[model samples]
Target: MDAATSGTEDKTPHRFHRSLSGLGVIILTLSVLSPGVSIFVSGASILQQAGTGSVIAFLIGAVVCYCQTALIAELGAAYPTAGYDYAAIGHAMGDWAGATTYIATLINMPVFLNLSAIGIAIYLAPFGIPLSATMITFITIATVTALAMLNIRANEMLTGIFMLIEFAALLLVAAIGVWHAQPDAAVCVLNPVHLDNGVWIAASIGIIGIAVNNSSWALAGASQALMFSEDMKRPETIGRIILIAFLLTVFFEIAPVFGTIVGAHDLKAVLANDAPFETFLGQYLPAFLLKLVSLSIAIAIFNACLAGFVGLGRTVFSMGRTELFTAPINHALTRLTRRTDAPWVALLLLGTSTALATYIPLTAKLLLLSGSTTILTIFYVLGVYIGRRSGRTGARYRTPLFPLIPLLGVGIVIGEAVVLWLDAETGRKSLFICAGAYLLAFCYYRFVLMRRPGGWKMRGPDDIDALVARDVVDA
Candidate 1:
């Protein structure tokens, strides 16, 4: 029997093709740039309120994201599954935990897609596009649909082109800032300010949350790259790719913050204004070039939208294939055209959900909440704990300082959850929403889906190795 028809055999085939060595660099760059734009734009306001200490906040958050990335990287190298967090959590924890995390991921897809769509619409408004909410939704849906229909290689090429545009735009801004640098400005923005202890702590926590929200987007897709591991000439190379991408992202994420803090003395003014970077460009650069830059940034919003859609599609496709949802969804996802091997059903679902999310109010809040939910549910801490408990016998990439690093990850996540709980603005309602969604999914799974005769079984170490080997053979 064909693998697809044989219940004992894995049906998901690895048909990925190798591309650029710098694929991780490109993906990371795009991931960082896309979210970095929104963060700089929105985060300026928070930085203003928090003062120069915002830099410290960002540094702390970046470190946390790196820790999370490190844990996932190890997991990804070992499993090399498209299922990513769903697979990792399932393998490390249990089916229930994996199912819960999967549901959070599902919710996150729409939240991010909607936020990207809104961001694109807002960015374009300055160009006299007059894009309404409805138009934005339509454009987002249509564009994503068309792109999703393309082959995987085509998608990568399109993403690479968009990343180039984004990189150039960011480079231009950095150049302008450097040329306009004031000698008297501070070397860094983390200057200490006198404030009451309670107020200072509260402000710092809030700012850290914002930074985490921004930087986490880049780190979010680290596992997604593993989905393409079969295509890599050396699957182990994904580890290096992830490390390089994240380090580069660190530099890119921090550089502009330093420039913005130095250039704009009035953080409040910078924050309150829409498109602070564009405004900075207008004041410091030539008028015509400023317009061009603004257009580029607007186009960047679309780039982010498209990239988000692609990631979301792959994530859902992976989950469906693993039988976390329904067998029909998996069947649909695996029904790729022989020529391109792109699943149209998964793509259509991604586009439809993204378009729908655009209409939701408080999209930015939804996005942040969604990210937090995923991080919490997936529990990088739990993964590390499990790995250490399993002993280092079969580890492909063992994290240095084993127990400590993993323990630290768990502590940080727990600490962040506690802080969020205390900060009412960020807590209560969002947690409730996430909880309610998971509970509903669990009910459905327990009552209906689990009764299915055939589904993918959650695998142990030997089983996972077998699965990976099978995929390699199929490829």
Candidate 2:
């Protein structure tokens, strides 16, 4: 055991070595955000729904995402643990709320992994990769799971390398648009028109609002940085890292999206193609370069899956350290490999689950709701409120403007939930299904978990002062 666990009585304590630099953490965060794939997917969806007005929608989504940063930064700084959102909420609110939210979030991890892994076939087909989707998914799961089992720093360097290629793809897209600067390109942002029944017409505010809400998916992953809090070489810098990651994610995702919008030679033709970004690039670039960009998309998807696997493994490891589950499960989860100090058991379990889930054909709406900002953002807002009310905001970093940032986040997400409820076809059904899942989770927490011995106790870095007093390492 390291010096951090020397005095603590708990045996087999699951600990993370503070070996990840702030830049490494940022790279991992961006990898999880996956600007390249998000541009191809969420960006294309926004273009289809709002057309040129997608630029405005992206800006609004960025603003909405920014509002939650304060809550994240503040809580992250206070409880710099791998448990992430659960740790912060557990400390601020209570054990039941934290564990329930953790359960809900954990159940959704495979949905994202399957979607990202399944998407590899879409991008790689252009590169003449002959593998079927099932084969590709299995290969991706095995490869990323192996990489995730490496020491955190090794994974960091690998992800950084992949991130460079990802950014290059985005930069190429932005450069093409700037080079092909259209005279009426400004109208795409200002006037915002969509082709309606073969005629160009101004987009309505409601259409733009829907686009903005959808764009939230494109910009949502920066907060994944909080999952690496305990691994940071300097945890105090986490707030700054999260803020920088958020801003950079907004820029990188928006640049290529806007570039594709303004740089298109024929807006109608580009929008009509299902793969809008690839179609736009095909018009300008040589075949080899187009294929190279397509290859970058595949790499980006793999990088995202790898980074997400690492985060999810650490999250489970944290829960195990806290002894939130049965003793046997906790013992298994906390078993880090001696050589790498990596959570191999947890990583393997989640990896196998994701690999199995790839065979279960799920609807697009279900996947979308799984990653929705509505419920998770509600926990963040509550964490902030409870933190402030209980005077638990004594971290190195604090949210500016008191509660304004979190409250705004709450308002925006609740509005998003309302939008989901009203849209019967696309979102309402998913909301109803997600509500059932959430209700079941709550019941599990209240009826089952609370009745267990010691009752869902969570151990984390909630009080730096106490750690200092006891001369125990916080990270």
Candidate 3:
């Protein structure tokens, strides 16, 4: 296409047309969440920690997710940019915090692709697929990257289809688990406690973090959909779409988990197993159905790589647009092809991170270098708390509970991090590393990156507290 044909560049820097519908948003949210994998893996983590009462824990986590997304919706409205995580934080918290949070939170996105790809490998293992997990990951990355880079319409269509497959997979597990469940299973799972005792109570409290992690992991998909705010037809409706997505998360994830609890009727056994759903289902389900369900699980997870790249690519491109990195790389990362307006370079950069997913242990993937995100998100909670009413107002959406809600969000998230540290082995091992990462990223941003002309001009120090209070309201 020639210059005349291409028309003017989108002044919004790496813009995506608001072509994604409300339904597309829901699919994107669910797809990125990879509920198939989360349910099987994270559900077990919750069962191990909280047992049958895990449903309550998931509800609590959902409330937290609601508050976080409330703030996220406002931020998306204010910025209306791709990679809104950093963009909103940068605008709300300031340049330095934004830059650091952007780098720190990078780990969370990859796990979507990583875990989903991991699901693919695990599901196909029974068939003796010659491809190694690493090879499969690379192929997934390449394919998804190609589709994402192809066109927005194609990407949405593919994701929407894969999302339904995931739903079917979850349904298969939930239906089977519920149908074969013991008579007392329903009453037992709803019981207030699985093993009422001080030890169990303490364990449950600590496990709330894990439950919340799974809940958050599922909801995180909903939260991440804001990265494409520029692509949504109605920005305000993002909140509503997210709410619906949460309901789906509860149904697909919590229902199956509850069914597993009922079917197994062994709290200790569920807790000890990493994939209780798989274990119980395997016992009752015939080999053919089991293999079919396994394939569904893999396809569901495989969908995440596509959604993950879209999110991760946009985040990097957003940073690139601001010249967060050095010029040569930054220019490339932010560059857009005329044919598709896709961030080809950014997609390639994101593809590089797939290597870690194949090699790292799940605990390491979940905990190691993960603390940085919690720390930065605290800044986000605090940012929205203050940033909401900081300047001009008269907006379409604002989360109620105001200071109290955001304050509670900060406290709970911080509490989760601390609890993870004191209680979970994964938290203990990676605590210092996560903390050290925040320190390192901050130092680099302050002393190295910010000192450069590109970073200095784009995100000057004085602009940190500058208000983005437009379209935000008192209610």
Candidate 4:
């Protein structure tokens, strides 16, 4: 297909064109961020250290996420596209940075699905479902692949419904915990003596970092809403949607942390055993209610996996469109059935990769690396820095405090990186793995891939100028 005739102008398949409301955006955000049961389980160890300060850490993490959201919101308002980090980082930093971001995202994609698959198994274990690890893995892969093949509008509806169920289930758990609490419930919150200032402060800071880090999983694809900015009733409305999503995620993260601390005295022991949320529910709620919570958590994991697949597919599609990958992939992505413009090939690749990763036990490590890579890519939003520096004026939404918020975001991420470096067992291995992945990508792009027929050249200043001119002309 010729570039002009490749349906780039009609990128939105008819099925994908339904406008998403601010509420839909919030639900999507919740689906992405509210892997409530999974997150609670993962962070249990960290929260134990946090003591009463766990709540403080979550609040701080929320603030950091808010800053990053603001930075992303500004960019989304200006140049909303599907491959968010890929596009923003590429545009701001350079081809190398952008390509590295894409690689990281690609690696992280399967890891996210795998994590959700594990979550599904854990959620189902208490009900005597007894799914094998391999069975759960394949099921997750199949479910995500089937969902990705559906129309975008249909997927959005599914996301909204599942997210609502998740929110309801979580609220139910919180209420049940409160209702079934012993008189000593006050002791959980009111005991100042239980909180050692020095320990609490240290734990709080660490937990805050963990929370911020984990928010990447929670806030994974909020930017995808902006990808459909061109299809929105009003593009500016995307900003409000993003803000609402951020606020909802903050609430979701904080509430469960508060609930768990209130209910469990030995948070570490509870978390170490895994499925702490289910355990808590079993201890306090009726059997039927406990079952419901467990089921809801499984649904939540499915929702998260679905969201991850959608975002991953779009990122690959966008990369292909820009000729960053092999032209064959781009050709396939650009091809649309009369029925839909969906990039079926990209979707298939995404599903296949995720399925293949299921056989490996590296999902957790990959997730950590992916999260770290994501934070690193935030530096590409130098658009924030450039916009502030040049005093560029536009109708786009602006982040508060100009460069200060972005700077803080950079500082916090660097601090996290330092902490990871200090803990070589986790951080160093991840760093090396990421570095190795990038090196391979670089070699492929430079030596083998770039030499292929119809390979894309890196965009330079002249290309940006031409793009800007075209935008001006179209506007």
TM-score against native, each model: 0.83, 0.93, 0.85, 0.81
Report the candidate with higher TM-score, 1 versus 4.
Answer: 1
Cα distance off (Å), candidate 1, residue 327: 3.5
Query: For residues 1-475, could you state the per-residue lDDT of candidate 4 as single tens digits?
Result: 1222545443432213445566665565566555464355554544544454555555666666677777777656544556565555554444555566665556666666666666688677778866686788778778777776665666678988888888887676566555555555565445421234333323344454655565443433455565544334455566667777777666665677567666664544444443556666666668887778778878888887776666566666666656566546656654433444455777777778777877666645453554354455355346567644443312356788866887876876676566556556666667667667666766766676557776534332223335433543554
- For each candidate, the alpha-carbon lDDT, in order, equals 0.58, 0.79, 0.65, 0.59
Q: Which ten residues in a row have the lowest lDDT in candidate 4?
A: 192-201
- Which residue segments of model 2 deviate by more than 4 Å? 1-12, 364-372, 461-475
Q: Give the poorly placed runs of model 1, Cα more than 4 Å off.
A: 1-38, 192-221, 265-268, 363-378, 391-394, 439-456, 459-475
Candidate 1 lDDT over 1-475, as tens digits, reads: 1224445434444233444355743473355346455444555544554445555655676777777767777666656545655666655555665666676557676766666566666556656776685786678668866875566567667777776776677766666666666664463454433124323333455555655554444334445565555445566556556666667666665666556656654434454455566666666778777767666666667766666555556566666565665557666654444555555667788777777766567834553464354455346667657744654112566555676777767766666566556556646456656667667766765665566676335532234457655543543
Q: Which ten residues in a row have the lowest lDDT in candidate 1?
A: 192-201
Prediction 3 global C-alpha lDDT: 0.65
- The sequence of per-residue lDDT tens digits that candidate 2 reaches over residues 1-475 is 3212333524534567788889989999899878887898668878888889998999998888787766777777666778876777766677777777777666677777878888888888876668787898899999999999888888888989999999999999999988897888996779988877767889998888888887876787777897887788787788889889998888898998889888998889888778888889988999899888888999999999999899888888887777767878877787777667778888998899889887665775364453346777787888888876766644567777776788788788777887787787767777766666667777878887889876766676434335522422322
- Candidate 4 stretches with Cα past 4 Å from truth are 1-18, 35-38, 94-96, 177-221, 227-231, 263-273, 367-371, 374-381, 387-394, 439-475
Compare the candidates by lDDT and give the number of the best one.
2
Residue 420 in candidate 2 has what lDDT?
A: 82
Candidate 4 yields a Cα-based lDDT of 0.59
By descending TM-score, how would the candidates be arranged?
2, 3, 1, 4
Q: Clashing residue pairs in candidate 3, if any?
A: 48-271, 395-471
In TM-score terms, candidate 3 sits at: 0.85
